[model samples]
Target chain A: MSNIALEVRDLVKSFSLDGATINAVDQVSFQVRSGEFVALVGPSGSGKTTMLSILAALLTPTSGQVLIDGQDLARMNEKQRVKLRREKIGFTFQSNNLIPFLSARENVEFMLRLNGRLDHASRIRSDELLARLGLSDRLHNLPAQMSGGQQQRVAIARALIHNPAVVLADEPTASLDTERANQVVETFANLIHENGRAGIIVTHDLRMCQYVDRVLQMQDGKLVRTYENKKEIRELARGSIH
Target chain B: MKNFFLASYLAIKEVIRNRGRFLLVALVIALITLLVLFIAALGEGLANGNRQYVANLDAQLIVFLEKSDFSISSSRLETNTVKSVRRVDGVADAGAIYTSSTEIVSLPEPLKVSMLGAEPGRPGMPPVIAGREFRGGEAREAVMDRNVALRTDIEIGDVIQIRSTQGTEDEFFDLEVVGLVEGQSYFFQPTIFVPPATWEIIRPQSQSELTSDTPYPNIIAVKLADPLQTETMSARLVDEISNIEVANIETTINNIPGYSAQQGTVQTQGFFTLLIGILVIGGFFQIQILQKVPQIGVLKAIGSSNGVVGLSAVIQIIVVTMIGVGIGGGLTYLFSLGFPPTIPLVFNGSRSLIAVILLLVIGPLGGMVSIIYAVRIEPLKALRLG
Candidate 1:
């Protein structure tokens, strides 16, 4: 079996703005192994969001391949890509985009429903997952009735419920308080590690890097450095990195 | 099928959760349904009003004066013409029919009725619903349409006083109501069937032209030996007889004064109402889809196929529209019950059913644009992530 859960092979993404070609992601390559929780950290306009979008199969790269479990995204048609996204990849946007009309539990179960795996067992699993996320009492409440932190937790549960091979989160704690942010990041990390799924999160706050197994730092559309040492990761989490 | 159920469940759940928002759209659809159904009913009513009398005729062909434009009122056939028509080959029976407008002297106000004179038990006479057909040699007996009988409160064995004219002055004739027929109206007025002798006395005759003291009937209604041979037999009659015209029942009914014009006007109005219904439904759903773009994007981002999202939207529209149409149909039934029979509003089951089917189909047809717009909503742009 392949140990790598996700592989990005020299991915490049370009856009045209005002008749000028700008590369959003330029020849960046990385691999996330199974059961590893990594963080992609960068400043605004560092192309982190664009990179995450490509990994989630929401956007196509200009060149290069995104492989999930050794199957290349570039070689697949749109229908195949959609099926892969539904069955193997999970994502939570920065907005915690839960359907407003659905209850907290229904929002999380929606992923399984999309894959046609929702059943009584999955429904019970949904409740248990919400309970794990400290939202047992709010499962029946709509997104509008839940707080920002609570909605984010529901989104995390939704992202992991379908047992996707790769879980991609972009700024999962952007709207939470510091304590709640730390708690959410810690729980997100625990879920990823426990589920043995390759996970990646993009965040500007280096302090959130403490819960991650590795941190890939980026600048100017390139992966500049990585913090894999525990001491170095601790310093990075403390915002003491030079 | 499971995917469809999921889509349907989501659609129903959202509609239930947001009942207030959806109810507003449902109310608009209900109003449109009311207008459409009413227009359909009105069109049927106006058409029935024009054709009810002629439509019920048992004759296969109607003979008229050659230059009378095939109008029953303008056709003045002599007794010799009726005898000549009956003697033609393939002509099974020819009955003389006379029609005129007269007033029934009733309480409160006089009711206008179409006076029709036909031989007893002939094809020209309407079938009786109650009492009995005119007995042989019963000249003073009359058979009233249900509308006239019900409105005038005259029953069997009751004497009906009708104001008639002979030549110069108006006179009253007392005719006993021996029978009642259902839904017989002529020229937009309730009809009363009388025998040929009473018709002659009530019919106006000129004093200077009183020859043999006998009155000639207006139109001759011919029943062919084989109904399918109407065209050939009708041509034969017109060829054999002079100064006469022959037409089938439907063609003669179409030639009724103002009938085609009235039907065309009502039909045009009904079509316009249907068009407006399409526009209203399409516009409502388009706005609904526009407001739900981000939600749709979230669904797509979660890996829902285009079919799922589109099916959900279509299910929502059909559910809401069916409810609205049901309410509208119920309301129409309730409101129509209060209308008097004279209101000229006829609601037939088959026509209403057809109209309802058309209305139901338009719900999906009109929402197709919204479905396309929804399915085309780009996840990246809608989520504002790229």
Candidate 2:
């Protein structure tokens, strides 16, 4: 309980679409301890994006609370929320959307620069992360110069460069093939387990669900079930790993 | 911060990538700058011409007649009126000047000249190139400008015809062209200078009775004790005279009505033209922001703050603006050389500097506006994109 990295209580989010109120995320609850790798698995429009947005503090939940290390997220203003996202959370997106202007190394180093923590001290860490991502030779290549998997790997490196407490990856494997996807998932799992830094990956691919410690299923913007699986592609809604 | 640098780097990268659009914007800026420069050059030439003319004269002010529009003929200042102005507060000295515009028939081309009759000590009419100055009270002796002397070759003893404005009575007198004065104005006309007594002989007071004009309008010279009081004295004279209109400083410089107003309009139009430049240039950056919205979202999701994003946008704007204005101002200065002498296009660094600063400020302001649109973008939307 004291090691819990994230705790969410009954969260709700609604949007008016064509004058009809649709609940994008409704009464979602979950908890993950430090070092845990959690997977939020669901089909498209299942509120995974909305949940991820709320977790990142980019969007405020309509109801309930989000507690990261027991610090309630509901009380923070926009400034504090931005600060919280800067200092504690890290994100890796689906498309490996790297800034085209910078080289591979600068792209990864960006996470440190934003928090006003970029300096000589961050250089070694950025280099190390790039190397660990198997991009040491291509560290100077821009996003336009690299392949899909390589860019995604660099993005992951960017997310982890700041040593954030929690890493939020939204469909990190969507743009990659199976081999690349597996490799990315394994890399993420290895980093989370090694650093004890909690990570939550949102994916619809059931094949990759076995890599995470727990998988939460969402329907109609609510959590419907949880599965714990160590085996890849176990029966959905039937497997659980402790 | 890491986020700001990252954001700015991305913004700049987007702009540099679209080299064609950026170049187009710069070219348009240069064109608009050229128009303003053209007008400025014309203004500059006019000012220079006036200054050269005034410096040659050593006269502080030009006194022209103030008259009612009711009469068909142009009214002239009386001989007594010249003395009365000489008695006015700021007057240090005075001279009687007689002027009439007439065409001389002897040359290959009929030259129109302003025939001046004075006592020969006026500030501007000096140094007779071929003859002496208008000597004291000589009714028959006259001096011509250099170009006039060259055209007719009328020496010290030749006679010339003074065409009367009344259309029938032309005075053909042995007007001895005693001297020739050097000036560009001489090239256009045969300017003859005679004493007031000579003007009295040539066009007598008998002509004044036929028309509303005074026969001998005094050719006045107003020597101000203090040059600074010139404005005050001019204003007082204008107010005292029910018909005179005082031309302002800028008007005197450009010799145009409301010169300051015209300058102000040109400056303002230039400002807005540069504003259009900003929009076109800044529009590139604004697009830079929107295109990077997804990237910004990713950064936000990755723990990058909003301030970091905003800072990056502003930095990108600063970079582009400085470069754009540098190129723009440089081109403005470079091409202004070919402008005609009739224009006044002064390259004022301070004014251009202010324009550049305003242009530079527009860049950041442009970025900031885009930043508002950027940081508010949902990090989650980045997740949703294909």
Candidate 3:
């Protein structure tokens, strides 16, 4: 409990469509400790994206408390929340939104640059991270020049470069093939554990769950099940559990 | 300040990466700048050409006939009027000036010229740049303006024939150019100065005025003891001297025929050009921001503030506008070098400076709407994540 990096208490997000209220996220609560990698597995309309957006500080929940490193997000203003997001939280979208004008290394260094931490050591670290992700030769290439899997790996490097307290990714491997997806997820898990950071990845593919320490399954905007045992999680990844 | 630097960095990098696209936009802006500058120069040049002679007069005040309404051509003052003006208090010196239009048949093209009559070494005589001034009563000696010298081959010691209507016949007089004065254009034509006696004999006359010998001058130019007291002296001259209206050089210049209308038209063209520049720049930037909505959304989502995004757009606009204006200024200078003096395209320094400042300011002003649009973009809506 002392090492917990993220805490969500009774988080509920509602939306109005055609004069009817719908709950995108309803009374969801979870915790992830430092050095832990968690996978959020759900169906297409299972509120996974809404939860990720709230964690990224991009959307506000109607009623809830989201605390990162023990600082409640609801207590901060918009400016302060933006600062907190840049300094303490890192996220990658489903499209791996790399700036097209920036090269692969520049894309990764942008995260550090946003936090004003882009120094010589961070530059070296970015290069090392790219090399670890097997993109050593593509460092100077623009996003248009790289394959989808390579771009996804670059996105992962960008997410970790700033050393944020919490890293959230939304379908980061959605564009890659199965083998490329597996390699990217394994390297992501290794980097998160090595850096002692809390990480959450939202994905519909169950096979990617093998690299995560635990799996939380969501349905109809509710947390339905939790698979914490390593063997059971592996069995779920092997497609034995519905 | 830190945010500004970061925004500038991003803007500069994007500009460098997309140099070709930005260069094209800059070229468009440069062309628009050139058009505006050229129109402004034309307006100044035309106005200058019309009033150059009166604008450079040595006298501080011009006395015209009481009902002439400040027009030098319409005013008629007898020799006694000039003498009375000389006797007025604070008057240093006063001279009578006779003006009329004639054609020079010495040139193959028959160039029209404004013939001015002035006493040598008097207030009405312009300073000579080369050679000697015409004698006080010399009938055939004249000082030609430099524009006449530029348009024709008649130099000092060359004889030019002036053709004027006298009574029912056209008479020609042979005059030798003794001196040259620069930039004394009157009514958009090159001017020549002759003595009063010769002007009276050969100046244009209607059929009915063939026998009139009054030798009335068009106006009287008055020099004051203290140039700073021009307004008081002008009032005193009008009050003390009957049958006369007093005016300063500026009022005399403004009363030139078609001067105000020409200036106003050219100014309108330049104004429209600037307005078009704003619209074109605003439209281009608005489209640019719209196309990059997703990229801006991503930046916002990753913790970039609206200030940073809007500032980057502003910096980009200013940089592009500066480059465009610089290129246009260079091109204008180069084009001016190739223009002949007859083109009436003078670039006055202060006026050109003001025009350049306005051109630079329009860049940021034109980009204001686009900056607001970029700042107002919602991150979730832009990324389609909501």
Candidate 4:
């Protein structure tokens, strides 16, 4: 099998607004291998959200090929796409939408429950993952009872518990303070790398780029630069390369 | 099967987590159910009060005068008509029945009572429970219904005074109660049965007809040899006997004055109650779904299919409705135990069962629009990412 867990080739998504067609995602292409964490960073309206949505299989591109674990999304029907999304993809939104009624552990195990794999071992794994994220004491706490940072960490645990081929985080730390943001991102990175999952984090905060293995920057719906060197990525994380 | 379990888990957990809000809505539903069930029971009770005597008649056919439109008050049959009806091929026996209304003055309060006169050992006479049946030729003996015994101190062997208006003056005749029979209520009043000769002497009369003694009965109760062949026997009796119309027991009961109108009014009230139930339930769930659009979107994004979401909502509605109906049923039973028999509230088992089934079905039906709305919510739009 190839090392690439997610591959996107020339993806384009266009929307018709009051009769005129505009391209939200214009001919974007990238590939992330297993165990690699990539950061997609750009200004607002630079097609970062559109790119993430297309990668999440939530929005169909006008024309493109998105293959996760060697299965092409464009060739699958709606039912098949939903099944694929459940089995091969995991995403957390900007709000960290943990179901307010469920406790921290139940929120994490919901992913496995959706996939019909919530057994005793998966339950134990859910507890262990939360414990690794430093939420062992807050396992039975509801989202309303926990802090914003604690809720975001629970969201991250939920994303990784299902062991999907691709893990996507869209502004997972947007609701936290700077210190809490750095802690959440570092833990998220460690869990992704330890599980050998291809992880993608979409953020406009340049400091969050420090935890990622590579940084892909976009401008005017195009890839403007690629930062791959460890020193260069470190400099970008310090906000010196903007 | 796995999907069902998952859906149930989510639905039940949410209901438990937010029990206060759900329980309030369920209580509203329970109140609605109680209203509907009470209306149904009232309808049954009123109809039963009107037709109990006619409904309990042991005969299969009631022969009324032709052109009387099956009305007991308007129909008149001569005493010889009973013999002609008994001579018919399919009729086993026939008896003359005379009906009138009078007031019983023996009690502290004047109680209105239905007076029916029939011969002893006849099909029209109800079975005795307390005392022996009155002899056929007795002029002053009577048998009272159990409802009369319930209302006052009158019982078997008691001499009750019957007050009737005759020639612009109220005359009272004394009669001894010889027997007590159960549940012979008619025209919403307790009944007293007497021999035909005594009925002729004491029945109410208008001042204009103080001297005329018409020896005619209101109708003839005919016992059929083959009760299952009522249709054929009715046709044969109409053909054999002139100036007479033959109706089965059900048709006779339905034709009682105000019976159909009472039933229709009560049924219409029940129907409107169910309509209000639908609106209340529908409105509550619609608001609930609107408030949780974001949560639903997040669920959709996390690989929860529309099937799971829709199924979960349905399960929630059914669970809530079951709780409401269960409480309503229990409350209805407990409340029914406290009512006096004069209030006319009775719950029939099969009718109550039908009402319960209707109550259960309306829950899912009322939540259908909300279910469709939940299923159509796009994950991208719900999260406000698009």
Show model 1 residue runs off by greater than 4 Å.
Answer: B135-138, B165-168, B204-213
What TM-score against the true chain A does chain A of each candidate get? 0.97, 0.92, 0.97, 0.97
DockQ for candidate 1, please give it. Answer: 0.72
Model 4 per-residue lDDT tens digits across residues B212-289: 665578999989999898999999999998999989998998888888888889889989999999989988888999
- The residue-by-residue lDDT of candidate 3 on B117-163, one tens digit each, is 98888788999999999986646989999889878978899999999
What i-RMS does every model get? 1.3, 3.7, 1.2, 1.2
Candidate 4 interface RMSD value: 1.2
Please say which candidate is ahead in lDDT: 2 or 4. 4
Winner on DockQ between 2 and 3 is 3
In model 1 chain B, the worst 10-residue window by lDDT is B206-215
Stretches of candidate 2 above 4 Å error? A17-21, A229-242, B1-24, B46-62, B68-76, B79-83, B92-223, B226-286, B303-308, B339-386
lDDT of 1: 0.87
Cα lDDT, all candidates = 0.87, 0.67, 0.89, 0.89
Q: For residue B341, what is the lDDT in candidate 1? A: 82
Ranking by DockQ: 1, 4, 3, 2
Task: Report the poorest 10 consecutive residues by lDDT, candidate 3 chain A.
Answer: A88-97
lDDT preference between candidates 2 and 3, better one: 3
- The total of clashing pairs for model 3 equals 0
Candidate 3 vs 4: which has more DockQ: 4
